[model samples]
Target: MFILSGLFCIPTDWHVLIITFMNAKVESWCARPEQLSDMPVSTWKQLSGQVNQTCQIKNIDWDAVTNETDISGEFGMKDCTKWEYDDSQFQSTIIGDFDLVCGRDVLIDFAQTIYFVGMIFGVLTFGILADILGRKSVLIILLLFACLTGTITSQMPNFTMFAISRVVNAFFIIGIFETHFTYCIELVGGKWSTIIGMGMEYFWVIGWLILALLGYLIRSWRSLTLLISLPSLSAVFMIWLLPESPRWLIAKGKLDQAEKILREAAIMNGKPLPDEWKLKPVKDFENTKKTTIFDLFRTRNMRGKILILYYNFFVTAFLYYGLIFNIGDLGGDVFVNFAASGFLEFPAYGAAIFVLMKCGRRIPYGTSLILSGLFLLSVSFVPRGVYYKDWPCMVLALIGKTCVTFAFGALFVYAAELVPTEIRTSAIGSASFLGRIGGTIAPWVGKLSIYHPYLPVTIFGVNALIAGLVSFLLPETQGQELPYTIEESEKLELASLIAPSILKPAKSTQPMEQEMIEFNNIPEKVEENEEDNLSCYSGDSALSQKVCS
Candidate 1:
């Protein structure tokens, strides 16, 4: 399973890079001024290539116009970064000076807008079906549609048709990316869940990295999309080899099939099945209860669920997407910027791995988001010459990129952990659906700030701020067990809410080494996550065991 997800890295980065690549060119073109009417014939000759090219807008003074406004926020900086796009209205969506870029941007603009629409709607529809059907069935459906639609979308005949296809492809395909955490949780025992499930998304950066490289080579979003599109078919075939979710099977009373999947896992792990692994008669999860929308809203604890989802949806999409689309605005080598930006992501995944085990969720998740926001704000204030200079801007941009990557990695587990298993997938699916709203709006955010680089910083900063505060509203899921149901998972501090505080929570400043030694001793991946959680449970026992007699 990890291997398949690792493979997904190629296309995932490809998706971001290609999209970013497209967005960069249109933005850079818009930032420049109109060229002189009586320019040299040699310059006119330069106009020859620009005239008909789908991307280039002919006869523009790209240089003078950039002075009128700073697109990268740091008015004077230029550097390496990642984040990228084209379609006419779509072009306008991200950059308002649409006229300057020629009409080619209209098609690019529409394509991205339509694609996001497809993404938003596709997640909801697929999630409902996922809850009704087993996870495995929906897996096949999403993969098939993803494979066929993604491949077909690549061959779109015209701009209008292609834009519509982006929506369709996004709708059918995005459900899988959104559902991965839930599906992984169901597949593994509690112990191995966080690293394996969330770790898969780190490799997603690898997909963006690939596209960054490809942007240097292929230079077209269409070709880049086409290149990765081939993998969906293979993904369908590869996933067919995977086992179904046993928990889902048991929920539907398909105990026999559930056991079969479990046996496969046991064999894969080379471990003997527990005695309780034997298949038995089962009953449906919905046997005695009503499952409805109100169920998600009725509980006080569920409100936390809503808060986390909305925060994640908006923050992840807004900061991550907005910045990527705006990367080219910094006025540097597009390929270098994209690659350097992507390279920042490698450390983020490693940081997440350490933080998830040692630091717990709240600090890592909350602080990273706040830091990302702070950096964006910092970029706005950095003196143009000192901060906006090539290396300086690159350094800041990379720092900003790293923070978002960390937040995203943490959210995979944090979001999934917020809800109970029954509605967990649906919750994640819904939040992610709305999260793509940030993605939908990001291009517009970029476009609106065409002349002002600091505009996106303000916009993304607010998003980061909202996400960080809302994160505080959520329970600390780090030391907590994965909730079996929404009820079991959250012990709403109602009593403490109203009652006088008994004791203030103590801060731990114990050296990091003690924790590292305990962490390093774990023999298996499952043992690490499980031990961290179980060790929390065995607080007294663990302390006693370590005590000197």
Candidate 2:
């Protein structure tokens, strides 16, 4: 069921790339007046005297021009009142449909920024709601609303309505992403957590690949959007098929509900529930204070961790989306380049999982960021006019994409591991909110190429380097257990500082039992009656054992 829920990533991830095609630039020029309708296009261009211009045409008196042989002299240029577009590349797009050319071209970027702004709100709003309302209910709601908004987006008659629908669609899309991510993470533990967390990114890459194909085949933006959105309607039925997170149920003091879910899971796995097992709510579940984003900053150690996480998230989204949006400027077939970008992520994610499991999270993640920065920075120095220059630039950019993809996958698992379960979604949402801010600015920064082609890449590269350096300050969570509370998280930080080399699994050994018992405040006498002690403790025995260890 958890794996099936990952299908939501299709529309969510496809929306991110569809913007590239939706606002694609097409060949356009000032429309000839009705009086010159009989003239050849070549003759019309000669008269206009602004033949090369897309947004302006020379002020020409069509009534005075009687002969096609009459060549035009230089005339004052004027803003084009009407435009004609060539449909060779794109049959229709927001750019051509809305005449977002010349002075109004920036609206394309503005619309994308608005979409990301909505994503920021979605992450925060849905993250909190998932914790309070339960992940299952929130996900079902988001899926239904996302489908509705996405369908409405296709029927918008004007740019204003289109933008409004897109922003609202973006809101629900991110909500589904965050709620689903939190629920999936809560379902498993230990090595499975790493596998599930990083592995889920593959679905995102698949969506990207499929979007490239769809963009190539469907040249009309409205039709393409409707096609991609229809699949989500099927996912709305997940309310009946999906189960609530047992972990979240336990946290909310719904012991019976959690037990029922766990028992079913055990049965599905062909492993019967142990006769001695019991459902126990976390200690103080009723009295526990609700955690919010502010709680992440309450402790000195957590504050430092979250600050570094924010910067890393910002740089990741900035560089990732910046590179994607800039693909049109890479001097090649945009569809082919887009496909290559998505294809490279497969190996990148594979490499990420391998390294994350073997080498831990901090070093590999930080190094990937630094390496990607170097690749991006190198693209500027590859001589521009050389016959092979475009190839080198494309190669470097694709390599950077791979590196950044690796870093992105690793960061998701790492961030989830660092934050405690109680405030996990909120903390992830807060960090992701910073990422959306960076994503919002990426389009405008891509526009900086008008002044200097390398300016945006240089900025992305430098920010990545700085973020990579800061990432090392975060403690390694490679073999460590997921922290359930602020105090537990702080202990992991202190342990990393003190014993830096000892990387052990969370399972308790005889020698570590005393430390775990003291940390969890369990009486020594409880060790004599392990079965009774498990029943009295909060959360699952695995979690209690982790705490004890």
For each candidate, the alpha-carbon lDDT, in order, equals: 0.58, 0.76
Q: How many residue pairs clash in each candidate?
A: 38, 1
Off by over 4 Å in 2: 34-43, 61-76, 274-276, 449-453, 494-549
Q: Put down candidate 2 lDDT per residue, 102-207, tens digits, no spaces.
A: 8888798888899998898888888888877888898888877777887899899988999999899988888877777778877766555677788888888889
Q: How far does residue 177 in candidate 1 sit from its true spot (Å)?
A: 0.2
Candidate 1 ranges beyond 4 A from true positions: 5-16, 21-101, 104-107, 189-191, 213-224, 274-287, 290-293, 328-333, 385-394, 448-453, 490-549
* True-structure lDDT of candidate 2: 0.76
- Candidate 1 per-residue lDDT over residues 1-549, each given as its tens digit: 655544642453344345554444443321222444344434432432332332334333345533233332322222211112234313222232223234444656665666778889977777767776756667666666665665665566555565666678788767777665566665543334556656776667677666666656664445656767676565566456666665556545576776566555655556434443244323235564735434777767776567666767777877887777665555567677667666777788888877777666666787788888888777777666653354665567668778888888788787776666666677777888878888888878877666886787777876787787667655555444444454554553222322232122212222111111112221222211243332111121221122101
